[model samples]
Target chain A: MSKKRLPNIIAVTLMFAMILLAGCAAQPSGDLEVFSWWTAGGEAEGLEAMLEVFAEQYPDIVVINATVAGGAGVDARAVLATRMQGGDPPGSFQVHAGHELIDTYVVADQMESITFLYEEEGWLDVYPPDLIEILSYDGEIWSVPVNIHRANVLWYNAGVFTEQGLTPPTTMDDFFAVAEVLEDGGIIPLSLGESWTVVHLFETVLLGSMGPDAYSGLWNGSTDWGSSQVTQALENFDRMLDYVNEDFAALSWDQATQLVIDGTAAMNIMGDWAEGYFKAQGWTPGIEFGWVASPGSSGAFDALSDSFGLPKDAPNRDAAIAWLRVCGSKEGQDAFNPIKGSIPAHTGGNRGLYDQYLQSAMDDFASDAIVPSLMHGAAASPSWQQDIIDAVALFLGGRDVSAFQAALVAAAGDAGY
Target chain B: MRINRDRLIAFLMILPSLVAIAVFVYGFIGWTARSSVSAWEGLLPDYTFTGLTNFIDLFNTPRFQIDIRNTAIFTVLFISTCLILGLVLAVLLDQRIRGEALFRNIYLFPMAISFIVTGVVWRWLLNPATSLERLSGLNLLFHQAGLDFLISKWYTHPSFGIVAIVIPATWQMSGFTMALYLAGIRSIPEELREAARVDGANELVIYRHIVMPMLKAITLSAVIILGHTSLKIFDLVMAITQEGGQGYSADVPALNMWYTTFRALRFGEGAAIAIVILLTVAVLIVPYLVYTFRSEVEA
Candidate 1:
């Protein structure tokens, strides 16, 4: 009798497994999953603070803060892709503002346009129109940007500058003059870090040399990459590299920032996260360290943002919309951006809550000629950025500016610029 | 009836694992292979038959070319250094030295920790390259030791940066190779050495003529193991250099494949790279598999 019942047991177990799989297909309506790469330091803390605000506002909805941490969304994007492709997108996810948002999700039709949400929240008056344009594609906006990170900040050691009787340079000619004085005085004029930082520095140089409109044209295909202006920018970048430390390839962005704080180098041109790093290391911003809108790009804001988008078929539609509302709200931006070390994407943020450097960043964001940053995910597709990275990497080794420019033109062509 | 029942039960026991391997392993491999030959460029899976376009593009690309060169240099350096050092260590240990167990444990400890862990530690030791004023890590140590001339730019060096990466790879893996060789050394019967000595052969001659010859199988195993690891090196290089060191100098095929697929979102190109890596590994492994199976059958 037991032997005959064995097949029956097997059939029952198979049926149970099928039932379990079927049961998992029905997601709970009260659950909202927010996926991101913010799993460390102030960024993580800021994410939690926003979540707290979200939780207080909606107590019934259970949020799963699903984070796969790697610096700058490297691992998180990979995980997000796998989930989105497998038809299991989270309720919401953090992404860079422009092309990363557009080329990855919007084009793939993974994200639902959040234009209705923006209008419902009355965000049109709060968010700058230009920023909204960055977040939109094909006449529809998708993601709600939370914080704007400025890419063209030139950070320097205030003590070193004071002792040398020098001020921060405002133009390309002024920069080289200052750089030369510091070099002659046995100081490395600039501190550059690894490859990506070089790209960051190069972008600032490009912006400063050509000004904002021409710089913006490089991405939109209006500016010819082989133009004399681009050549001048390349020559400037090559000159800028000469002022960097000999062992720059070994340092990271933070390490390079540390060079400024340590006064081993007078300057470091990096994103505003360098300010956060300095504060973490017990240096007060605008006192121990000083920042300028990287030389020649003073009147411009080279910006990238961390934004959240609602995916199609979200598990908790209402909760996800509520989450996005918080992401774009003045209160949410105030709570998040201060700790997150970025300026608020929403212009209505409380400036009094921010520090000195951040208040200045806010001022710059409000008034400066805003342009999308290529180093971060604003101006180009992910593939185009990789091409730039590879070209820059090769150029660093070879220092062939003409070849580098040619490569840029080729890359632009490939990207359909 | 008893025999039939026993066979059925045995089959039932292995059925789960067999099915899992078939579906998850072989099935995915087949899927990857199919995607590689298709024109799937973006997030959406378009399995339109594109036929080898991605492969052609990948080969023509300069970055991939650099990666292949870097991998070749890394493999040759990593394998040779590990084998020589491992054999040397094994020989030294076989001398019945005092604290032999202690030394052996210390040697094998690095292998126990992951390549990522080893890489994170080694990254600091090798970086901040060649600056006398800001020297730190091993570079600083070399400075104090009056070996300043010995200092080079570690993994940041343009021409030989991949060679610096090999140092860490060898440090992590040579211990395993040493363990294999040590076991091989111990297994070589004392009688054979005695007979060689009795025949007027010295210690050096015994090792060269008799002992080294006896460890041929062990060496082959070590080579096969280390060769495959060197060929598909990813995590260690990633943890250390992140972007395969400056100028694609330390890049491997696996690292390139990752960026192509995930970062750049070129699924077809990425899949093509994956198949290429698989083929490279197969070139190393299939012959070994065949040899091992044949040897087992003969035994």
Candidate 2:
């Protein structure tokens, strides 16, 4: 109340304000921040549904559904990285299962090894071994995958295919033959989207050309990127590029799928997420559209799983564990994946919950050999992945297959593969 | 004694901003400079001095090289087009034509919109899709107008994609440049123009000889403003042609820096890019500051 003490009060208040503004402020008790990029229709609803399960399990805890909206975690990952760098990580955050989770967080020492969670919950037996493999680094499990998305689905307009009396292409030769017929018939043979989707298509082409083993070999030291097989794959991607819509650069992945839906394009190489886009547009899976494994990639599942992990020093550690458990549990994944339009990461998920398309995906995911997706951050480090994206973007303009292959070789060398 | 007290009060009033700028501006800049030279990567900081390794590596990278080239093209085209277009619009408005305020608002409306919106709107207006089914923008207009030869791939053109970016940049900034030039033109004495007309100078000659030359300062300011924005463009490029068009044909250094630092967690390289951009802008601005200060002192 005294005039002389007023300056002291002001100075003390300023210091407190600065501290609060600098993110040292504590969170409210029982509050948890679950971070993700699932801001779109079904995926967002899917996340909400899983959170409802978590809510039922832990009614006392409050969940903050933090989201950053971008396709393929483009903007979200960057925001998450900065937040972690600032030492203000969310309680649990969505991350891709493999090299993305390892190289960005685990290797950087920002993530806790949730291997204990796996042990405590008996997840070691329930989750698929390959999914466990991708989630592990340095003998430690880093995250729990919620859903598995097949990244190599070749969805075609069934009407277009039937009109041409053609089955969906199952081999490289079949693809080109189908493409020629479609292109000659004035339909864009393949609908492609922007740069990242192009990278996605290129990944499937590589898998299709080389099969799962050789394609998987590209990421490890086993396969040579400059090998004749990769060269053939690059050539295939180049020729496929010629068959894509001329305005491919201007369209997003959904827009590309729309091209197939409207019958402007005959086929599209996209992830299973396109199935969600198709259904959202009122096109039924078996009726309006048909899907096959991308050419020559049959019996191989090119997989990318959207997983959630606990960061070190998370504010709500107990709540985060609860959240992770929900992410990995059979009850939660079945709730989430049915709405998310993807199959469950937990093999014990309810089979009847998924629809016609995801059931087939689940079958393929069970029987087929699994290879990691390059574009979705499983096969390579983010840096190396960016290099390939840039290389693909460049190759798109130039159509120089050898140059693209050389760039891939260089990128692999840089990644120390 | 009273005057000295007043001066002290003024200094005290400014002290907070001065100290804030010293810490937040120059201090952070210094911090960035230090971080750029560190061997940091992957969401963690390592200040082990790495010399010029980041800069050298960036220079050697093909993407960075393409970025520098794109920046060069963007800066030159953006500044030149903004200046010329701004000057022309200003001159046309100076004719005291009908609905001058209306035309002025129309020219300046794009400035009211952010670069993101401008980029988005222009993205639709200048779409490069050559296929009829996909062509709905400027290309479609060109087709309808029987100007098919003028229908370019715009930003999708491999070598000249950044040039297409200039159209949007100019669309957004030329209004600002026009306002500046219009102010410059209006500030020139009406009597001088009247005297020139009395001395038998034609309208074109009066503008070229008197009004245009007097806009030299405005031109310099416009160039610096437009040049720097073009140098470190991010949001506009992000909105339009995010994959850098095709093959990063429209990619700028700012976009690359963003991806490197935030996406790839190459903080050192990203900071190096930020510093490079700052230095390039400083190159454009430092001399202008010196000249303006010297002129103020002379005055």
Candidate 3:
């Protein structure tokens, strides 16, 4: 109640308020938030290993491993869109290279050009020139690709194939012949999953049936979607669907792969991530399951890469740049791809670190013709990809081949192909 | 002067909430309407006026047509099933059975859990390959026990896939409808039923003529509630079938809006889908709202 006591009390209260305000106003200076959808199995372990290298390099930076769990970044992309549109982007986030990054983020002016970082870190020379082209738009690099996943891969149970006296098929005719044998021997010839996996299989079949040149041409306005080649691809796809498991609609990709692992299904045409799933199930690469570039897609690499980019208004700019540097470095790529069951995007990756399947993939990457994957966000924009998925879903449900082709042509026009 | 002062005080008290609703609810709806008529098709909002192009495109798309068909099938099946089951259960409970509270709570418990949970549980049960049949070898058990016909592909059947979705949706909502019917049944006067009995009316005749007619208001309320829920269904379909059945057999407008907006980044088409859903729900709700308000004023 004394005047001196009141002044002392007021001074103490004001000091506490200022301290609290300072705490609230402080920016995340030493924090780096990396947003991704790698929250399960070997993918999560690969990310954790890469983050460990980043941590060893920058001990002061507290890495916020913000993960949105969903298969194939479906949930993460929606969450990222909301956050970016709301102007509260994370420090950095994972994006697929090529049109997914360019059409969605870079074209919208939501991403910062990382060309200078590429030059400074010598990534321009390390990453392949074609990959650099895919990651660039309007003469500027947008994202740093860490790992390359081959989408066109036919994974089979090696034991089943050896016992059935069959080899991995080399052509559509070979596939049907082997499939008939497997079917006669009481095996599901091919294992397939839900709608998206069906789309993935169709894209590989397209690549195999029409060859790489025509497959790439489908996206670049050079090839007609109504061409006979596409019609033949559709016919082959329809025939191929006949050999798939009857319960394809109810299973996820991993569950479908389980049929192959358990020796019930002869083959599954899936991405290289299936290798990661196989390994996580304690199976060796060439011993338990085997992979070849999907049937006729031999001599071509149907590729998609997972990359990270800095948003325009990202918090912790320096830390995000450091994270991108780590994502692009040889150490990071080597550390990531070995466990991710993918190959390093940069050619500088140590090949000894990879397993037998990825080693073969690396060899093919060097010798084979490279093409973008339509199902994996490399060859087309998101809207175009969704349209293809819809068309494929309808086709799987017994639509005519002509109707399926017409739908693709219409969707291609909408995508400005 | 006193009345004017009191009116001013009341307006001041509710001014914040009025502003909040005006901005957050009506303002957002207006924004969505405008966006629906724009050409913002990609990731970013362009907002150039394109008239009814988005709406026309949505109508022309076969997937959207399928969505409309699926919604009609789901709404009719869901609402009628809920009503009949709810009324039957309410009538049975009205017989003054033992463990009445326990039965009531048991029926009402599913209503307390979310639709997402119900969808998940039903998804497991309905999936032939991964459900109880596969997990516990019940399919084998059935085969051994001469019940092989019982092992049928439930949700995975392409033609009747939406029917499979309807089961879970009805399971979650019929309980709430039963509560409504139960309260209506209890509120009915015993004197009316006694009078009807004195007129040589059987239990079925009394229910068909007297109790059912008396519960008209409750039935209307249930219909309105169930109608809008069916119209705006998203989480249940998403959880149950993830990305719809084999050929988008279970696709609805709300799921279409979500994928179009968030996944495909076609904001203009997404807004058009949203407007369509809103209009459908409004068609069911506005008359009921108007009737309730008019009745309140008259009362």
Candidate 4:
């Protein structure tokens, strides 16, 4: 070949080589891209704990965190939807374990079936049956349960309780008596953040006071909304609301939690996640604070578990499956739940790795002293939750309890669940 | 031949911009309009046409109705406030005030910031924890005498949700309006002012009779831009309201459409709401837009 032609041939070969290298670049073997809306307060810290353990366990795998900052996890869901529709699904994304949600994904064949993983790892032998129920859709496990969060725990300042000569109330009557005492003393009995928090506290009291059988009936659409027990639950919520502070509606959860921390409010009826915030603030359980099952609701816990599922046609299917395994594994539970301030899903993991409060939670779970009840994203269909928001807003706007109950029922019916 | 060459050069120069507008603006709009009709909830096209059913549900929704009302109020207030304040500020600045350039830059700086960023900054400014309670805590001797109403809980209360939206919307947009007015004011020929001066017209009189008349085009332009923005105010309210907080007090049409489609997973209804909002905006703006452009062309 001519010298000039030889140079051209070499250049063409280099171009092809560059293209090939770009196409088959050394992508990380376990480059797992996980999505969750955990970019605030204790949630961020909790996520970091999981990442630390994950890195140690799978050194070759890269954990690409796609964290959106929002309290309700709405923004993260929007991003996931857009990405998934664009045919560029994420490796894994956070979702609550529920039949309605999982069924939708399953019907579309949009989720990766993890029944094999569950069977292969013998997860059925360890994880609670209730949790397994939450994780399954159409008789197949499609997601990994991470934490079982009790939504009915009433967090209160222990110092305030002791100062006021109060023990944790065990019944509805006791609760009202103590609430009145706090009210008379000019301390707000409830630190309720306007909308979702009000619903959370209200639902917690309903579940805790009504017990698991009734609570499950209500959630499963078997209990008629017109039933007297349901009406009684509504009345209990109204009674609790009467004890909330005047400034309650305007306050955020963080602000309301601060009120409890500062000993201004006697109690905050919130999910177990609030424990993480308290722990992050250097507060100890049973000293600086304490928790109880909702007043009059004994021996049953309403729980929801946060889990991760792979979207259909996930860009990195293998990596996502690996991450799901880790999420369900003993090490994953050990790393995640300690910082998450919730009980781990893995049965054999050390429950003692958690603080005093979480250990108590673990004890509650093991003794079948708790029932899984949905709060936040897990309790109702998305439509039902939104209607609750609307109804609560109306209720706070001075609508009566009858109106609130009617709206709630109608909204639930409208969601077609 | 010369004119043809000039036209070709001009079209070539603007080809990239024209393509961008067509692809990004018009293309997405067409896509969105199509999506509004279909049952595509999560990403894939569901291809089911529940014609006008989504719209019917959307209109029936108490939340969506409230949003429409809120958006209308916001639009009227925002456009008028921005136009009036902007014109007044421009007139004042055009008086050749001291530090005019600095003030102009300060006024226009909000325009440079994205709406999300503006929402964040304004949220901090208006947040009860950061500003309201902070100010009330100060022991200034004169503080107790007055200005306390500025920190009224009315803005944060559900009944006063519109006030919450208005404050941030005005803060982010008034400056851009001011800049547009300033440019228009500056465009008025010096000879016209000289003629008014010769007739012994005072500043206010001249502004009312002379400068203002000349600024009809600028006012129209300012109102159109501000009106469009007010109609679709989303990020500001989204950042401001917590989930379940005050419910739909500050929920505008766009946010309602978003929640209806995505959060509620009612894509059909969400699409219907979007089309309604789009049609409403178009109905109001198209005629005004035509008039404004025609005047500009004649000028």
Candidate 5:
């Protein structure tokens, strides 16, 4: 009888073993799901490079790449919110500079403090002091800075510049002069993308055109829309719109850059990420593509930095922190920013390690007084930025400066900015 | 009394659908209504009741007003065009035409693709450069005729925004209505067609008097389905026009709600928009649904 009962015991033991195995398998070791919006043309390759290095450092940590592609942060943030609200937050996610998070991240205390990481990495001494200041809230670090993207760079085709017998425009007047020359030469003057982000290019020009103090004043509410500086900036932005592609409203960013790459358009006002696109197309930067400061900014740069934040209640909190460390590390920066085609946020990040255009960007970033871009949802309320988009759209579509300014004033009032 | 086991099984079978409605449908509505009354941001809902504040702000928004007007115009035009075109195709296909299977499948296939996919493909087709380039490549015929105007930056033009919204919607939904009409036509008894023919009625007369009247039930069903879909239209408008709110012309209430909740991080206001849109759709659809249910009971 005891022998017959042995088979039953064996079956029960097998079932228990299976359950134990399943439970063990469900327990992940240092697995982190990283969320970001860098899933387009060249950004994808850059992200892959960063992940490759990350994998090399912590071979046990599994990194899940969750990227949503929309021109702006809209698509990525939307997906992240839905997930977080559904109680499945990613270990880390990308957020921009300024108060974009106050409404959600700060209120919920969902952001984890990365003070120790920043301090331990000695990033306090390396990255720009202003960047460190922006990342601070209530005297604690809440995110890891990844890369500094200068949004005001004007990229032009070298062949087009040569054919037109022109140099990269250094001032508003020069930009228009070159644009006129290019148009006369039967080349498209500017390759504006179809999204609302073209408003970013316009704002970059406006920021530089208004000068740093006046530009910062626009964000800090120190300057009124009635100011002559703002009025002139708006006028120039409107005039510049005339050179944009007729189909600018519907062209994607890559397509806009393609016109430059194909030598159809003379220049494109875009972020450094355009370098990634050019490189992906088998075109070497500084050879097929070139960069210049936004017109009116001789050396001033408009920059937006991308950073990663760990939500407070991340399941694998330690793992998430480790990933943030990797993101801010010199090795990680070298591996990531080259493909990101952005300047590294890591202090003493190896500039010699990057491609030529990015290296040049690093030089400019070092030499220039970088100003905040309003389009990055920094320095102003989202409502204010939204209003600016509306104001810009109306202005670009032929609204008078007075009406556009009124719209801005009204929006500022509405957003309590 | 004898137990009706079949009725019990039928109720059991319908239980999953009823739960789905309760959870996804009713649950979301209640949650959204509660959220609308509270100040919420990001993933967090602030339970503080700022009474009528969000609604007042939403009403004052010019973008919201434009979105409402665009939605209404789109709903009316989209429904009418889809019905008219669907009926034409249904009538023509019902005539025992050659390659009826092929034609039927061709008309029915658009229904199979999801709105997301439909929007993606249509976006490319409507892109001005892409369309013009493709058209010009067609032996200079289109280029000579200046057909470039047909493409005219359809997604961005305020005047053509509704047309842009309609094309993809009509592409996807017309197939559904066509199938309904086809089913209605097929359901007609053979004797009815024979009787019409024997009465010396021409094809148009037979269709107008006999076939069309027979299709009233199917047409009403089609209208109700399409009407509800039109009221809740989001994806096509979002895709064709970059969510339209960015430009201030293409903003639908759903897109507005999304922007408020996620982009703007004003969850209370976003939830308020959601509730308002929910009520609007409910007002349009609930009565029709009740009527349909009553008719089904009578039948």
Candidate 6:
């Protein structure tokens, strides 16, 4: 080859390489990347089942399961923030249904309004009106909620309860009575976990003490934070703390549930996900463990739903819309919720697929007065939720009830309550 | 002309790296400083100037106060323990003992691993309930051996949680400090020690007057490295204690910054924290850099 021809050949090769690299950098038009924090156990399985349904519907589209593993989507949120700020967004991402979606993504204008999709699919008729209200901002729905989790379920060892001749508590008085018996019998009355779980328990206690209407008012500025009822709730929480496991700070929610599973503790207040954890441990629902609507919250469902939304500049917009459609469908809900241990967000979900506990939860969800869960990001903004967590942490350390109430009020003010 | 051309070529060779550092490091820092003074509270970058509010709020928050206290406790304990233990180990190794390589390697192995790995391993080793007790039945052994007093609530201790974190931090870093001291000790001329001994100075006297003063520069370097690390410590705390570590007892500023920025979407507050950390590290490092540069020029 001639020397001049060599330079031309080198230029041609470089151009080809550049084109190949650019092609590699671009996402395939038919590929949908679903980002979430479900990386373990039943949650991961449920996500896979949903993806399988999506894949079956659209054989041409490839689904990318980009799961960032951490307890409560902590790491995944950080990754999503950076990616979105850097002008790259996944096709769709999992977010808690209410203010977590509204305040974090929608207010920031990072989420694309899926009101059109909802209208086209007639999702407004299927999903609960209250949940739709939570997902909407400025008269447009932003997300497609997959499943509803009841945050105020009190799970207990049924055998232990029957052996001790104690009934499931339905009120604070009943709870304390059962606690007294459990403590006298040398068993932990409540199996509390780390900070978030403690926060979760406090929210349930607040719900029980304040009741559903007053509890919802706490987030919406109608309920005075320093009111007598709020004070009573705080005191109730303090009393509940007295009966919790001493090693509560070191354990995760599941580990705390393990205490109940092994009959070391009498009860644990957690979401329906705890049921999934128990089933994963090979424990039957009614025989091995039992659940109530938590003490003083019998007729109330403390609700937090997990939903997926389209990002503003999703690379695969069509695929994402299709995914959302699948998410809201009855078939998808049945396939996902039975495995996820969460009740379907849609009222039309098949009840036969659910276990006994979920069937009851679904029933309660239909007839019961529903209240938002603060710890699970339904009642308040993410900033307010974090502030409450910090305040709760301080409350746990010092047990100063008045100071905690003051902090909550201040945090609410800061979050524009 | 040839010399000028050679200089130009040399400048061209370094231009890419200089530009890269300028844009990536210093430029980003400037941008962060700008963000720190802004009113950006949520996911969107507002950039409206609201000077010092975030910093003022940070100073007022009880959680931030706890972070400062934890950082102070962690820094003092981590550095002092590593230095003292490192010096002792270096001195012992300097005795020219048998199987010296094995001992040295064993001492330095923790340093070879990342802080994240060290954190995870120590998290299990120092767990109050499920770790050593459940796995090896060491707590049971202690109880049977009547050494139950040896067992305590390790990382779970409320007041001393940051101190527990310090143990893992020191474990990963002390080996590096030891290697530094060992090199410093070995580099001291044998003639100085010999002269001191000839003058009827004892071993202790020789070490105090001759060897210790000679190792001053090494100590300063170690302090600067360790101080900066302690100021910006994040991963070890995140892995071991996490955000809710025993009522936020183990929270440091870095962890606080991360939570504020990402979780809460309070970018302004997070940027202020970053600036505070940067200024703190700069307060320690800038003087040393200046001194080193001046000394190099003099030499």
> What are the per-residue Cα lDDT tens digits for candidate 3 across B1-299?
99999999999999999999999999999999999999986667889999999999999988888889989999999999999999988999999999999998998899899888888787776665633324423345565687867765655666567777888888888888999999999999999999999999999999999999999999999999999999999999888777778777777899889889887899999999999999999999999999999999999
Kindly list the per-residue Cα lDDT of model 1 for residues A214-302, writing each as its tens digit: 99899889999989999999999999999999778767899888888888899999999888999998998888888998989988999
Model 3 lDDT per residue over A1-417, tens place: 888899899999999998899668633349889999999777899999999999888777899999998757988999998888888999999989988988898889999999999898988877777678778789999999989999999999999999999999988899999999999998889999988889999999999999988998898899999999999999999999889887688789999999898887989999998888888789988888888888788998999999999999889898899899999999999888888789998888898999888888888887788888887888898999888988887776556899899999999999987
DockQ of each: 0.44, 0.47, 0.36, 0.22, 0.21, 0.34
TM-score of 2: 0.94
DockQ score for model 6, please?
A: 0.34
Q: How do the residues A1-417 of candidate 6 rate in per-residue lDDT, one tens digit apiece?
A: 889899999999999998999668643348889999998877899999988888787777898999999858878988988898888999899988888888888888898999998888888888777778778789999998899999999999998999899999999999999999999998889998888899999999999998988998998899988799999999999999999876677678888999898888989999998998888889998998999988999889899999999998899888888899999998888889888889999899888898999999999998888888888878888788889989998887678899999998899889776
> After superposition on all CA atoms, what RMSD does each candidate show versus the true structure?
11.9, 11.3, 11.1, 11.0, 11.2, 11.5
Tell me what fraction of the real C-alpha contacts between chains A and B each candidate also makes. Answer: 0.64, 0.68, 0.53, 0.36, 0.35, 0.50
Cα shift from native, residue B85, model 1 (Å): 1.3
After the best TM-score superposition of candidate 5, give how far the Cα of residue A322 lies from its true spot, in angstroms: 3.9
Candidate 2 docking classification: acceptable
**Candidate 4 lDDT, B1-299, residue by residue in tens:** 99999999999999999999999988977877777777665334686765666666667767777777777777887788777777777877998889999999998887788777866665555544323223423222224666554554433455556666687778777888889888988888999989989999988898889888888877777777777777767777766664323645666888777776777666666767777877887976999978868979999
Q: For residues B1-299, what per-residue lDDT tens digits would candidate 1 score against the true structure? A: 99999999999999999999999989999999999999887689989998989899889887899988988888888899999999999999999999999999999889999989989999899865576788888989999999998787888876667998988888888888899999999998999999988999998998999989999999899989999898889999888888877677777899889988998888988999999988998999999999999989999
In candidate 3, the second chain superimposes onto the true chain B with a TM-score of: 0.92
Off by over 4 Å in 5: A1-73, A82-91, A101-103, A313-319, A381-384, A390-400, B4-17, B130-141, B144-151, B188-200, B245-248, B297-299
The sequence of per-residue lDDT tens digits that candidate 2 reaches over residues A35-111 is: 99999889999999999988887787899999998746878988888899899999999998899989988888998
- Range of the 10 consecutive residues with the lowest summed lDDT in candidate 6 chain B: B130-139
For each candidate, the alpha-carbon lDDT, in order, equals 0.89, 0.89, 0.88, 0.74, 0.76, 0.87
Q: Candidate 6 vs. truth: CA RMSD?
A: 11.5
User: Which docking class does model 1 fall in?
Assistant: acceptable
